[model samples]
Structures are given as structure tokens and as C-alpha cells.
Target: MSNDTFTSWENLVKKQLKTDDINAVLRKENLEGIDVKPFYTDVQQPLVNLPKIEESTHLVAKYHESLEEDVFAFLLNENVENLEQKTIFVNNVDLAGHISPKEEVQYFSLIDVFDEKNATVNDQLVKELLAKQFKRNICIDIALHQNSGASISQQLGIALAKAKELTEIYGTEILEKLIFKLAVGGNYFFEMAKIRAFKILFNQLSKEFNLNLTPYIFAETSLRNKSVSDSENNLIRSTLELAAAMIGGADAVYSNNYQIGNSTDNSEEISFKQQIVLAYESIINVFEDASNGSYYVEDITKQIAEKSWTYFVETEENGGYLELLKQGNIQKDIFDHAIEEQKWVEEGKIKLIGVNLYPKLEVKKSVEELYNNTEIKPVRWAEMFE
Candidate 1:
């Protein structure tokens, strides 16, 4: 619509609503330090695309090697010009047994050093990695912070802090292969903004380090959105989460099995196939930066970056992430956030589908039978209400 027509229409709406100023009436504030306007016009100021790269580079990256053989072979079948698409994420502890110079494979991988729920790289693994470079490229993952309810800004700041720590302890050489594995929560555009904000933060840090490096992001679906009782609904949640990751410029996407901390062959097959369908059948790869030029998305991305930068500076002033971790401030802060979130679920503020709404009568009736009577480990978000 023309600017003049938009102005006229806005005037009519303002009169109907009995408000003289539309911006004041319709705007709302968000956690990301931005205002949510009721409407949008053409760009008021110049804004750049998040990664500044073409869409082809952002095409869905790779698959989980843990999938059943026949299922994961889809990775081998999708031919491409380069060897990078063949890459997959692997645990650092498992690298020694799984790969060696003897194998004729080129895999781009994020060598997981620390996962808060499980383990970190031990002294021996660190020693082995320092001894010599392996065949596959490696990147360290800091996905645990997000899972624990840290804000997007905290995640970005902590990542840089951890990278610096690892660089000092391991070696700056590892940065050459560094990749960031991020867990995308169900925030849609905010999650998209998280990634773009990350790229911007890393780019600024790289300049400080005199390295012109960009991170290859591996996106994992969040554990927050998965529902145990309505297990079948996870595929739907995962599909949308995967789309957000790809459209946000994830080099690769990984979907978790619907059952939390439990992935059987069946779940693996389903998750892998779903990703294939999204990329190929659904054509998520057809566009480059699909969210680019979107007014709301672009604005949100900018706000996330700005807020995250402030967090980064505060983290540095507070003596980096390790110190904050030792003081238990980081964990406590996230825990407080989780407690607040739990209250929301309890109060019915959040719509968690089968967990809180639209549950089948049979499932509700069989809760005692189908559900585990024992304590659930690493509690689900909806556990308080359920």
C-alpha cells in the first residue's frame, strides 16, 4: 500500500479506537529491550542482514549420526558440491574411538567439550586433543546455558567468555575449527534474533582477536517445548523449531526425540525423516535468509543484539563467566527465571498443548497407568501443573 493510503487508513483506525496517537496506543515493551509496534511502514533506518551471507550457505547443515543407518543414509544421498555437508556433531570423548587417520572421511563437527547435564572433556581427552590435530574439524558447544533458562544475551556473552577461557586453556589454534551448537527455544522470532545476535557478537569479538572468522552454527531443538504425555505432538513442534533454525541461518539442524532424554531407534528415524521432508519437500532451502527484509523480525534482531551486547559488557566487568559460575550467580539467576516460568505454567499463562491444554480424555485418565510413578529426572516444564 502507498504511504499516503496507509496514513489515511491509520487515521481512520485511530478515530474508531478513539485514540489520537496510534504508536502510543499500540506499542508494547518486550524483554529484548524493544518496543512492539502495532504496525509497520517501510524501513525508517538502514539495517543489514544478520549473517550477510547467501541462503545457500544457510541450507540445513547436517544430521545426527546416531540415527539408524537406513535413516541417516539420507545424508549420503543428498549430493552437493563440497565435503562439508558430510559433517556431523560428535562427543569429544567418543572421537578417539569413532575416528582416526585410518578412516577416509571428511566430517565437519563440533567437538562437544561440556554438556551441563552430562560431562565435560576430561584431562586425558584434552591432552589427546592437544597432542595433535585430528582429521575432522572441531567446535565447542555451550548449549547448556540456554537449556537452564539463561536469557539470549547471557548465552552470547557466556559463549564469548567460555571461548576465551578455552582458548587460554586449550589453545588459540582450536578457534580455527570452532563452531557453536545452539539450542533454539520455542520463541520463534526471538530465537531467530538470538542467532543473528550471536553472529553479530562473534563478528565483533573476531575483530578484537584479529581473526575474520564466522561461526558455523549447529541448531538443536529445545527440550523446553517437548511434552511427554502428548509425545506425538513433538514432531509438529520440532518441525516449526527446525524451520526457525534454518531460516535463522543454522548451518545444520538436529531435532530431539520427543521423549526427553530417551531416543530409541524409532524416534531417531522419525526425527531424521522430518528434517529431510522440511528441507527437500517443504523447500526451506529454496530461499536465502527468508526472514530478511521482514520489518518485525529485523527490528527484533537488532534489539536482541543490542541487549546481548549490554550483557556481554556486564559479564566482562563482572570478571567473566567462570567467576559468575563459581559464585553460582548464573545458575541461581536462571533458576529464578525457571521458577517464574513454572509459576506461569501453573497459572495457565502458557499454552503447552497436551501438557496444559487440548489433552485427550484417555491420556488424562491413563495418567496413573501411562505415567511413571517415580520422580522424573531433569524435570519437564509442565510437571508442576501436570
Candidate 2:
């Protein structure tokens, strides 16, 4: 529609709502403070011309030593082809004894040295590891950011800052095999735009260093919105989250178990099957850029990128990510947001089904303890309500 036609429609909306400001009646604010209008004609500003992303996402499953063969057997039984192409995220680095010689699966190690969930960074350990020129993927796991209640822009900015700090400490060689593990939340469109926006911001950061780097983003479902009592609803939540990750153009996707804390026996298989159904049956992986021409998503992506870039710049000026973490700035911001969101849930402002609204009579409270004395901690929002 033309700008003139848009103005006419705005006038009609204003009259219907009986308000002078059309935005006041129709616009909504997202968690990142971005304005979500009811409709869009065209993008006001195009930030970055996004390149064509891959049509298919690589499936990533957690590796267990005992159930290694069983996992493969299950996949094969389900007609999952190309076993070699699948990625395995394992906590153990010593895969020599575990994996079969015939299998050619890729492994993403979760070494504590690089994991943000480890809380404190052992500088000497990191230097020692980097000196050996770690060949495996050096994960910058900002997935904890979302699980800790960080906003979308916060995640992007923090990821960029973390990458910058690592490059400065360990040199640019680390960027070659760096993997960004992000947590995909339940907000369908916003979560999709978050991944797209991060790519733009990361590219901009790379340009500042005179290097062209394509990020390998591994998207997983967030634990923040998951509830122990209402575990059944978690399945539906994770499916949408996985869909968001694939549509957002993640290099890899891992759907976490819907059952909270090993409550169900086949939770791992259930999670893996979620990916299988989305990839094969639903055929969501067919599109190169599913949300490419979407005006709403495009606008949200640009806004996130711009805001995140500004946050990154400010962060760099203030001694980067680690320095801020040591000063408790990063942790404080995330903790404050976490508390605020929990309060919203408590007051019934945020309707997390089966938590604040329509809760079960015999719901069990989460054993996941809250940490008040940590740097940047992981938290679940439903913990408060339960």
C-alpha cells in the first residue's frame, strides 16, 4: 500500500479506537523495547542486506556414553539418513573410546574453560588451552543469556562483546572455529529475528577487525519458560522454539527434553524426534530464507541489530564483556530483568500457562536453586510461581 493509503488507514484506526495517536491504540512493546506495530507497509530503514542462508539445518543431539549405540539405533530405526552429517554435543572430550570407528559424526565439546555457565573464567587455563591451538569448536555460549532472562538485544550485544574479548585475549585464530550457542525462546517471531539480527551485528563486528567471519550458530530451546508440573505443555513450546531456530537460519538446532529434570524416560528420544518431524515431515528446512520478505520481521531484525551494535560499542568502551562481568554490571542487569519478569508472573501480568494461570493442584516446585552470589547465573522463570 502507498504511504497515503497507510495514513488513511491510520486515521480510520484512530477514529475506531477514539485516540489521537494511532500507535497508542495499535502498537505493542516487546521485551527488547522495540515497537511492534499492528501492520507494516515497508521497512523504514534497511540495516544490512542479508546473504542467502542454508536451506537445511544440521541436527545436533546430546551424546551419552552408555546410550551412544542406542541413540544411533533409534535414529536408524526412524529412517534418519546421513548419520555422518549429524552433530553431537558432548561434555566429554575423550571420544576415542565412546564413538564407533565406522561413524563419522562431528563433535562439539563443552569444555568448562569456554562455557559461560562455568561462571568465572580461568584466564591461565584459557591461555594454556589457546596456546595448544584448540582445534575443536570454541563455544561462546550465550544461550545462558536468554535462560537467565536477558533481552534479545542483550544477547546479541553480549555475544558480540564475548567474541571480541576472546579474540583480543586468544587472537583472531580462534574465530576460525568459533561456535555461538544460542537459546531459542517461545516468542515465535522475535526469537526468529534474534538469530537473523545477530548475524548482521556479528558481521559488523568482523568488519571492524578487517575480517569476514560467518558465525556457526547452534540454537537450542530455552529452559526459562519450561515448567516441571506442566511438562506436557513444554513439548508444544519446544516444537515452536525449534521451528523458530530453523526458520531463523541456525547452522544447527538441538531441542532440549520437554520433561523437566529427567522426569520422563524417553525425553531424549522425544526431543530428537521433534527435530526429525520438523526437518522431514514438516519440511521447514526447505526454505533458504523463510522470513526474508516479511516486513514485520525485517523491521524487528534491523532494530535489534542497530540497538545491539550500539550496546556492543558502549560495552567495548567500558573494557569489554569480562571487565563488566567482574564489576557485576552484566550480572546485575540480567538478574534485575529476571526478578522483574518473575514479579510479572507472580502478579499475573505474564500468563505463563500452568504456572501463574491454570496451575495444577499438586504441582511440584523446582529444585533448581536460585543463586544470589554468582557472576552470571542461569535461572528458570517458573521457579518462582511453582
Q: Residue-wise lDDT of candidate 2 within 70-186, one digit each (tens)?
A: 343221212223455444554443432243423355545344345444435657645544443223456778888889888888889999988888788777777765778899998
Error of 2 at 152 (Å): 1.5
lDDT of each: 0.62, 0.71
lDDT of 2: 0.71
Residue 269 CA displacement from its true place in model 1, Å: 1.7
Alpha carbon RMSD to native, model 1: 6.1
TM-score of 1: 0.79
lDDT over C-alpha atoms for residue 95 of model 2? 36
Compute each candidate's TM-score over C-alphas. 0.79, 0.82
For residue 5, give model 1's deviation from the true position in Å.
Answer: 2.2
Lowest-sum lDDT 10-residue window in model 2? 72-81
